[model samples]
Target: MIHTISALVKNRPGVLAEMAGRFGSSQVNIRSISCGETENPEVSRMVISVEADDDAVTAITSDMESLDVVIQVDDLGRKEFVDRELVLAKLTMDRETTTQLMQIFEVFRAHVVGMGQETITVELSGDQERVDGFIQMVAPFGIRSLCRSGRIALKRGDD
Candidate 1:
């Protein structure tokens, strides 16, 4: 089964590498990863998506929980969780092309983060499928690079 694990770890060199290696060594297929520094300069949090069996998943999660640097780990299931992704594209277009594209973006609630006469950068935040749909619709123009944030889930309601 696939699970999304959010881990809060102490920010330190080699920490990420070690965690990634651990998953790899255990044969866990990591699908995506998104991380950022926490409010505390010494801490960082990551949302990692992986495909693994129950036994392998438990082993990895237990090891992660016992890590001296990891503060927390939460398993985000697919059905009961909200998933989001951010996509940015540096599209090269002319003035006329830009105007036409703006209309398309408006329909998707996406906006141009930055632009020039021949290039524009757009940002879109939504579910994974929606984001991929947008990319497919725009692939013809051009795509400089692509970035994605994995699923970050939350338990519903008043906790």
Candidate 2:
């Protein structure tokens, strides 16, 4: 099963590395990660996804709690949340193609961030599946480079 763990860690050198290493050593395969800065400069929020069993989840959570840098751990289990990802892509652009892509981008709420002689940079943000689907739709356009910020989630609430 997949578990999303939210960690509050002191923003000190090597802390992120330590937490990542700890999970890796425990055989937890990290699938995605995202972090949010906190009001205190010395503390930050880290959200990580790992694949493991119930026993492994408890063991890893306990070990994480013992770390000096870690101040809290919230288990974002299999439900009750809305999650999203962000993706930035540099794509080859041409006059004929750019117009078509512009229309597609509008539907996805993506923006053209830059235009070079042969390429244009586009930014898209949305749920993981939507972002992945967008990538596939634009694959024929020739992707120059891309970066993705992994799944970030918050508990769902009544409207």
Candidate 3:
């Protein structure tokens, strides 16, 4: 199962590295991770996603909570949250295919961020599944390159 773990930590140097080392020691493989400054500048919110069994998740969470820099940890896997990923794809297209590509981008709610004589670059942001679907749809067109920001999530309520 995929578990989302969010930690409130002191915004200090080496905090991320320390946390990552702890996760490594706990034998947890992180699928995705993102961190940013919170409303309190002294603190940062670190959100991590990992695929593991329940027991492993429990162990990793406990280990993370014990870190000196970590103020609190929340298990968002079972909570109501919104998750998203961003993808940038460069596709090769000719004039004839450009129109079809534009339609595909519109249908996917993606935008043409850049364009060249034989290439178009699009930026897409949505849930992982949506981004994957868009890539699959455009794969028939020659994809020159692509990059994705792994999952990032936030709780849904005022909790």
Candidate 4:
């Protein structure tokens, strides 16, 4: 099972390292981790995905909550939340495939972010499945490079 844990911590240097250390000590395998500033400048939200069983998830969350830097910790995987990931892909482009590539991009709601002599860079933001589908669709065009932002999620309803 993959657990998505969201932690709100003080926006200070070393906080991320501290969190990752805790995970490492707990023997948890981190799948992805995304952290950024929140509406409050003093705080940052970190979304960490880990591949672990129930016991490991509990231990990881408990250890995280014990950290002084962690303001709050929530097991988002156990709640109703919305998650998204951003992907930027550079695909080989040519006159013959330009129109076809554009159609594929339109279907995935991706937009061109850059265009080189023989490459077109596109950006897409969506859930994991959507991102995977977009990559699959564009892979045939010959992907020169790709970058993906780790998953970030927020719980639903007023909390």
**TM-score, every prediction:** 0.82, 0.89, 0.92, 0.97
- The full ranking of all candidates by lDDT, starting with the best, is 4, 3, 2, 1
Candidate 2 segments exceeding 4 Å error: 157-159
Give per-residue lDDT, candidate 4, residue 96.
98
lDDT tens readout by residue for model 3, 1-159: 989888999999999888877778888788888888999999999888888888888887898788788999888988899989999999999978888988999999999889888899999999988999999999999999999887888889998
lDDT of 1 by residue, 1-159 (tens): 778887899899988888888899997889988777878888998878888877787799899999898998777663366778888888768756766678768877898889776788899998878888888877777777777666655545553
Order of candidate numbers by TM-score, starting with the best: 4, 3, 2, 1
Clashes per model (N, Cα, C within 3 A): 0, 0, 0, 0
What local distance difference test score does each model get?
A: 0.80, 0.86, 0.89, 0.94
Candidate 3 ranges beyond 4 A from true positions:
none
Q: Which candidate is the best by lDDT?
A: 4
Backbone clashes in model 1, listed as residue pairs: none
Which regions of candidate 4 fall more than 4 Å away from where they truly are? none
Off by over 4 Å in 1: none
Model 4 superposed RMSD (Cα)? 0.8
Deviation in Å, model 3, residue 80 alpha carbon = 1.1
The stretch of ten residues in a row with the least summed lDDT in candidate 1 is: 150-159
Clashes by residue pair, model 2: none
Candidate 2 lDDT over residue span 1-159, tens digit each: 888888889888888889888889998899987777788887888888888898888898899999888998878784487778889999999988988788879989998889999898999999877999899989899999999998887667862
